[model samples]
Target: MNREILVENLIEFLPILYKKFFKGLDVCEITKQQFELLYCVGQWDEKPMTYYCSKMLVSKSNLSIIADRLIEEGFLERNTLPEDRRVILLRLSEKGRGFLCDQTNKFKKEIINKLEKFDENDIKRLNEIMQEAREIVTKLD
Candidate 1:
């Protein structure tokens, strides 16, 4: 494959590798696809169930199944808006909030500390790579 394609592939694969290795996480728990869906949904500040399927690029049935598991696990909740009963809102539960807070902090700090073992130039190069990816993605949007 070409350099650009290899870069794209690595960009997508690295997070999965890190999650598996460092987090001691198994993709089969949520399944990798569901995990991606949940991550995208969780990133949203305002979540409407109606829009989640389209936004996450998940099928209606699959979204419903994921939602059902999330609800059952007490990681997500469905609520009716007072202004409109037809409008359903999705928000993280207390368990979800605490879990994410702890996990994200631990993950981020671990990455930082691990990468810190490298010298200044290596760190600078890492930051440059991240910035380049961000710029490319932002420009595409």
Candidate 2:
């Protein structure tokens, strides 16, 4: 496929996939942006605010606002680098980890419910296809 066609297909497919299988699964009190920030922080250990700014494609000031809210809610904690007291790092608090875990399990259950019509063989094939797709997509990074 041509690059343009491939890009268009991805633009179409991604939202369809999310809406079908992942949308509304996060039945939490946080806003979508907050959830996204939590998800990004959950992926790694302590990271500086700058790291999150780049990863979330938000400005430093915006990222700080989200971080402050999460910190206030006890879902995240901020600590200054010991060596360079100026650099701030963020990490998930115990509550944040628990929330992320619960959210993940909820998503798994929802996905399983949606796949109930598929037989074992179909499910296995789907998993294989997804794994292959992930491997190929990761190469783009």
Highest TM-score scorer: 2
Candidate no. 2 TM-score: 0.87
Best by lDDT: 2
Let me know the TM-score candidate 1 reaches against the reference structure: 0.66
Q: What global local distance difference test value does model 1 have?
A: 0.70
lDDT of 2 at 91: 97
What Cα-based lDDT does every candidate model obtain? 0.70, 0.90
Query: Which ten-residue region of model 2 has the weakest summed lDDT?
Result: 23-32
- lDDT string for model 1 (46-84, tens) is 477768877777777788788788778787788887888
Residue 121 in model 1: shift from native, Å?
1.2
Clashing pairs in 1: none
Tens-digit lDDT string for candidate 2 (47-123): 99999888889999999999999999999999999999889999999999999889878878989999998999999
Q: State residue 87's C-alpha deviation in candidate 1, in Å.
A: 4.7
Q: For candidate 2, what is the lDDT? A: 0.90
Per-residue lDDT of 44 in model 1 = 81
Clashing pairs in 2: none
